[model samples]
Target chain A: MSPLHLCLALSAALFCTGLVAVLIRGNAILVLLGVELMLNAANLNFLAFWRFGPGGGEAGLVFVLFSIAVAAAEAAVGMALVIAVHRHLRSIRIADANRLKG
Target chain B: MTTLLAVLALICLAPAVAAVLVRNLIHSALLFVLAWLGLAAFYLALGAEFVAFAQALVYVGGVSMVALFAVLLTRPGRTDLLPPPSAARAVGGLAAVSLVASMLASSLFWSRLPSMEPTAPIPLRRLGELLAGPYLVAVLLVGLILTVALIGGLLLAAPRRPAEGADA
Candidate 1:
């Protein structure tokens, strides 16, 4: 009933949704969104544990801040790679990248 | 009161599912933004101010923009149509649903859980100090990893101009 439990449940659900998106979606962008969802879900877990765990207040907050910095850098590099690959391949559909089947 | 919190959890999840399931790419992207905002609010309600800011600034602002830009770059004339659903997708959905159900059941039925209230939370400065103290080795390793990743990304994304000997 507590907000902490609520955060956990939502994070779990989002992670599952992301799992489905990653497995089912053919588009690379959709897959990237799924990845973002999973990352956010993990972030929520950290924050919730912070709020309710034995390390409340600022320790969790500090860790979450570091996580955000990491996520931002990851996003930048990931999108750049996506752009570069798109330029080389002219398509974003994961299915279209059939050369990898070998 | 517990029921209300559970219901709100469902509300938070429903849009995330929709964001994943929608066939339209643009709709999926927009729904993803909403999902981030929802999670950010949830983080705030849970008394995680730093997490809320990170969700707002990093995922909402940085990741989402990058995703949208990637979408714009790779989409071709296929923008007018929906991608056909595949047979394998059903199994993936089933797996995801089963994972969610199992996690929910465990959380609901688990007889014992640790709930500790913090008495002395180290401040952000202390966290940094700790990271630099006993955790210094791990921090240094992560820094090295990130540095390599950045260099790799730069090597990959460096732009190339058009050839000079093209059809002049």
Candidate 2:
């Protein structure tokens, strides 16, 4: 298999695992971790493409940097939301959060 | 070259899958951090220096820490902290498998993409120029948005009226 090919497969696997965790899990923290895993998987894909795809090194590198900064910001916001949820509900379980609509 | 990359790629994926499957939330989060590190290694293998470092700095240093703190804030009594999947979670597992398989197949076959040219050096400086030249506006806007969000979070987390109208 091509080296880039292997990286792509790995990224895909990471993303899929993350997706599974996000979808089936009832814990908010686990869900957040799942999301982070998904984001990293995509970033890996970007880096791989940059390395072996068309973006080449520099442009891909810079773009990935931008993505990382954005991910950081997203993490901050996400954590804030988690704190809010924990405070309001006193439970980190997602199944219990159904009070809003259910 | 292919073998080296393949090995590195496997290394990246192992912990990533473990991150999702582990029982303890804290341990899983730690594994997630390691997974990101592996991805950074993959980036380096691809010759994308900036991407690799950015992954470490932003993902490892920034995002992962935030995730840890957020998770730390949540330590509900052991009454209810559900772990991994049961047989009922089979549907999700199936979907995940299908998704990974499809993506790999499409990228490998349908794209027919030519491997990057090995002779030409990566245009690192050009990216820098573009960042300052054309992408600065977007970057500044994003920063402004983040500032606003941070302020909003602080406001939300501020002390509020207690239930039963107790003034404290």
Which one wins on TM-score?
2
Q: Model 2: iRMSD? A: 2.6
Best model number under DockQ: 2
Q: How does each model score on lDDT?
A: 0.70, 0.72
DockQ of each candidate relative to the true complex: 0.51, 0.56
Residue range A1-102, candidate 2, lDDT tens digits = 565666667777787888777877767877877887788777777666766776435555556666666766667777777787788888777766877742
How high is each candidate's TM-score? 0.78, 0.84
Query: Where does model 1 exceed 4 Å of error?
Result: A55-59, A100-102, B1-11, B78-81, B96-100, B115-151, B159-168
> What tens-digit string does per-residue lDDT give for candidate 2 at B13-114?
888778776677878888888878887887777776666777788778877887777776677666334555556665766676677668766866665556
